[model samples]
Target chain A: MATISLGVFDWLVIASYFVFVLGIGYYLKRYTKSENDFFLAGRKNSAWVAGLAFLSANLGALELLGMTGNTFKYGMYVAHFYWIGAIPAMLFLGIYMMPFYYSSKIKSIPGYLKLRFGEKTRVLNGIAFAIMTLLVSGINLYAMALVLRTFLGWDWDVSMWVSALTVAVYVTMSGLMSAIFTEIIQFFLIWFGLFLVAILGIGEIGSITEIMNRLPESFNTLWSTSGDAARNGMEVTWPAIVLGLGFVLSFGYWTTDFLVVQRAFSARDLRAARMTPIIASFFKMAIPFIVILTGLTAIALSNDPGSGFSLLQDGGQVNYDSALPLLIARYYPTGLIGLGVTALLAGFMAGQAGNISAFNTVWTYDIYKSVINREASDSHLLWMGRVATLVGVLISIGTAYWAKSFPSIMDYMQAIFSWVNAPLFATMLLGMFVRWVTPNGAFWGLLAGMGSSFYMFLAVKFQWFEAKILTLSSVQSDMAVNFWRAWWAWLICFAVTILVSLVTKRQEEKDLVGLVKGLTEETLGREVPFLKRPEFFALLSLVALVILNILFW
Target chain B: MASEVREMKSIWFLVGLVLLVMGGLVLLAGVVELFSPSERQTVLADTHPGIWWGAVMLAAGSLFYFKNRK
Candidate 1:
């Protein structure tokens, strides 16, 4: 229950961040005259700009705190989220999927569904995505307020309202351009602010090797103990890790999530778009060095009785999320303390902005313009996008209050992803690769997939069936259940789509060109040499990924 | 085709400016704290990380600012 007091220098650092973001927003307003500018940042960013924004959109403070906490709980197995769970999907998206997405020039992912499937499928996805986005955004706001109130002694209402208003001001001004700018800044702030903890922790622990030596066998090695469910802290097997987390859930989130994909859509050219996620993959691989190492350091510190270090516990339950903030309190001086807090604040605000920006675009382009106002003008749609931004933030605030009343809702975030994105990924895969996939097939398959995933979650939650039946293991963690559920949902969707496609009428080959794989021409980065292509970098990224996994194993 | 409008400043330039200002402030605080240390010290306060890390930020910020400044 202790709070860290900020010095004058700390306040300065935090205030400067607010000023910079607001200034950036005000400055970019002129360039944001058109709907393209608001929704897609004018599609003029380089690979590096789009790449960092892509990664930062997903790198929220909640992930930082939770991952670091998860590390303290699950040990090195947590690194799987950053590595196998992410890198391959990112590479797949960049090298394979980006071409179709970019060439079609769709404003949002559901827009692509409309072109490939039908209006019903597009509206179905758009409505699901819009609801899912607002709920997650609201949860993020609640989590941010909780952290601020718990750690800095800030008022919860004030924290929520202040952060929400700041995001609204900036995003409403220039939209995604301002969002991308702030996201890039947040990327730097996170590195400079938090990477120091890993360094200082190593300084405290003597060495990285010493920290590893102090951990239990269940907590240190990544894959060595993953074969048997009983051998690891996560209580899951390698097959679960691979099929569930590594394959289905990973591909479902990374390849299909619009929050991240919107950044790639902002790239200036086709090659840049392809390279966006490829460039992000390298950085994604490096994040574990910050979160995983710090988690390991926390384990090493807590294990020593005389070190006088321990995690906070509330209501007799251990608060694992307190690890990173406690480390900041332990090592950061006055000035650096402010920088650390600012880094976390920037992360929370930028993440909220990313969600709202993506929501506004989907609302304006996919739902409102497509369903409600089919003949809306460019200027009218632009106006609608701004209104959506304000309304989205207000709904997010309302959702935050709702979450405050029922804290257990936070536990359902993974379940929500499985419900919406997992099945949608199956629909996307078939729609993109299989030319004979019918609109009816996609629509029915997606609904069945989403419904089944939700049903599976509720069944296990209410004890309608033993969770062991779903996980196929006697020992199960919530995380293990999530991974397995995503796999089943994807499998159901994938199977149902193929079955229904055979029974349904297919679209003409002419209508499928540039959307489906076999029908589309392979003209991506053809003029560029091997060394300059995204494939070369993706190969390098894959090699790095393999090496890191082997080294950790 | 030469136009009179000034070219828009790059996002990198803005990044550099924010880092430079924030880093300079941190470095200044670190220097002041080095001479007149706070009574409530952190775990490794004797090592003075604020000073060095602030300097690193300042240097990195300078490089970014000068390189990208229009």
Candidate 2:
């Protein structure tokens, strides 16, 4: 067994990265003098900045490492995450939803839900979102620690705590402002580091064709293999791809998750905010080339006996999670290794910071002030925000350890996302598009949706069903469980919301203005310029995605 | 009018400054890698990423920094 160690230069690079990030946080401290500044960056970020942060906030170890590993195991089928799953939903958010979010002047998604549904619904969502963010924060911390323990051979606890403390320091100081600024920097580092690995790996393999020749024919194609569950390198059928992930999970995350939407909310104007996710989708389209390609290159190199590389664990099986780290240690030299590892560290920290910051905002505005102390002053709220950041980080550290109990962390995280996000999005979609969805309907509907999802998860995992009722032919076990859970949950939530709304009194039409789809035409995106029209960009993004799919196919 | 112009100028100046600093460091790393012997290069790594990407960054920085300079 070979061990990869960091040299002095690597330490210097890592140290400098820490200093630069903390420096940005300290420098931005002056801007966060008020509660508004702490939560929303005073709504001062430009569209490009907001867009980059929007993209970067999601560019954590989950997307980078998890997707890379999945691509290694699943082949081109994994591109579904970036292309079909993300692009259309992001465009929809920018075109249709941003107007409502920006015009409403709401602090969080729960705050908006309160306006549309009622207080109980808001409280439920706020608590759910808070718990989900902590879980996600823990995933980032744990995944980074896993990678560090694999490469540098550090203790998991040490790696996890050190990473958490660094993120806690910056986020607690200047709030989201600091997280956004550092995310912009981390975005660049992640790209530079990944691009270097991709170029080198592709160069080694000779060409895309050369690399493709080494893998099975199905591995090179994306959509074609997805038609059959068993034919695709991964057992993801087109139905599951199109509906469960592309429709449900993607919309749930890009549209409703406060972590990313909050970045869009910090934009300077309605137009800028509208442009944030659209611009991100453009970059999101290109991410797979660097991320997924690196994984494929690793597969090709590791399979060749002469390459002197194999990411195999005991019993000569591939440890998919170690794909990216193994590639970094194999390809990059001493000094450059620092930059690559720094990029990974930046990704981990930025993700944790983004989660903690979102958690702080939701906790302070949605939970703390609304429920705990309604009469708190701005200064007092600001202090509470900092306190929440600390608490969020500590809880996340504990959740990081708890995450070890799961067999596959990525699958577990996605399953949790499916449970909460799908139902919340169903309620959100109904409340936003249909004005008649009463508060009682939405509240009970969300509860039923989440409840059914939880029951389905337990039933499938424990083999409670004698027959294969929940099983889908084309989808694998864990993902199949997730997709079915989300699909049924969304259905139950939608049905319950509609059923209960029929029994309850509806809100006045005047009050529904700018909140529902049909009523929002005047207030939403009334002044989009020719160049800034979201439809134009959406069309362009879709075209690019279609072309990539065809080329890969 | 002068103040608005000054504000825009400052924004661009800051952009240029950040670009230059980041680009310069990357370019420096590239130059060092460029001088290393060919034997030191690995098959699994890019032969000249530091130089290639560094030059690109340098060009972008120069364009932004020098284009609007007094």
Candidate 3:
């Protein structure tokens, strides 16, 4: 492995990219006319910007850096991330859940709840979603800082603050519009930069086929069929993969996560909004090649971890966050190395900015407007949104720095989201269609779901529930611990939501039709036509792409 | 009836193609072992299933790419 320092060429390309993105922020600043314009990009962003934003948010360095490292350490079952976990869930949400939000015409997702349910449900969702943004923003900013520090020896505080402030300035300056429009530039660099790293890396690995020829027989077992232990401490046993990654993580993220929803909510029309995630879904299916390849390549070049590479763990684990940047600095040539850095930075900003911008909007419109100051003027609300974004960015930076103390940033973020996401969905769905779902139901469901899940999380954290839970004897390793806990968390939250909602004044629980029918001032009601011709064309192309994928390998 | 049969046959062809690839990959693994047996790879093998999976993904993806629409 070679250590190539960042040269003048690399700096120039990266600095140029930064200038271009800031320029986009400045250019769009003037067009942000009213509160709507500032908040929602004047309700006019195209599919390309929306699509890129959706993808870029997910495309964060977390996956490129962290998941790539996982891929390097673990085998290819990482593909299950998109295939089993996200693809189906994405398509399902696009067809089923997205239309519910997009057509309902809510400014943000929780705003839709206010219309369908009551104010309490909206605020609960708003606050829950806001907390999610805080966690996500923190992780993303932390990751961005880590990438720079690992590469350039930049100070953590300086790196985190520089990136966070840039994102906040633009987002505060505009809103989703600024964040998304910048994504167009960011995604390009991320792809191009990653592609460059992969090409050079494969060459270093002594051709794709030669590397493939040396692979373990078990690695080819599509589902970890050979029954091996996950190297980097993942509790992915065989059956757990069937239920955990395949079911819960997939269903939970696609069905409930608002990062994707915010994108859907931002689209210009139903079709664009609906189809954007589907397109991004399929596009994501290709990411393992780039992210995972960089990971494995890091392994091949570093030659089993203990070689003092510092980038890789001796136990075949690469520092999940450093894998991508280390590879770029090690393998890529001068100018390209700089480009790669820019791209990784772009990936980080894309996630951090989207999180901050979204959290700010949610706080201002959903929680602040409804609960704190119901009579705030449009101008005042708009100003608060901008202020919230700035504060959100600062909190995110602080949290990112704090998260460094956690053992695994990736696992920590996922675990926290799991505690909250499923339960929130319970409240949301019941409030939507079940008109009789009382405001009390909303209140109690939030309390119970959050309370029970928190208790379950703590119980598992302390191993307090060892008496009743199932053991991992069948799985061949200790992998089932995380899976069992994930299931229990979602289950307990969901059960609490339903029981609390059903019993706490059933009179308030309105029927499904009446509640949803109340969601719009628009239509006499028409089902979103089964994705018009263009969308179907996109779907078919996506399928073809999948089939081609299977055949090609 | 003819169109249905045609579609069905193509579906099976696609499915069979998949089975063939899977079997080939398994066979390839066997060949690698028979040849290498005791050889430890020092050159760093990038054989993480993801690369090959990415290629197979092209097949899975083709199912989604529609040609029927304008």
DockQ of each: 0.53, 0.24, 0.02
Per model, how much of the real contact set is kept?
0.67, 0.12, 0.00
* Candidate numbers sorted by DockQ from highest down: 1, 2, 3
Candidate 1: C-alpha lDDT: 0.92
Q: Which residue runs of candidate 2 sit more than 4 Å off their true CA positions?
A: A314-317, A405-410, A466-468, A521-529, B1-41, B44-48, B51-70
Best by lDDT: 1
CAPRI grade, predicted model 2: acceptable
lDDT per residue for candidate 3 within A1-553, as digits (tens), equals 3334565556666666666557667766776667777666655545544665677767777767767776655545555665655676677666556666776567787776676656877887788889878988898887777667656777888888878888888888877767776665566557656775676667665676655544554433344342544432343555566565556566666666666567666667776776777777767777777876666666555554554344644357545556776666554444445656777888888888778877878888888888899899998988898899889988887788778887366566666665666566566556555555666766666667666656766676677776135435433232245445456555655566666667765542223333453543434224546455335745764585567446423
Q: Model 3 - which docking category?
A: incorrect
- For candidate 3, write residues B1-70 as lDDT tens digits: 0122222212123223322332233234433434553232211233322223334433432342232111
TM-scores of all candidate predictions against the true structure = 0.99, 0.93, 0.79
Clashing pairs in 1: none
Worst 10 residues of 2 chain A by lDDT: A466-475
Query: lDDT (0-100) at residue A191 of candidate 2?
Result: 76
Of the two candidates 2 and 3, the one with more favorable TM-score, higher being better, is 2
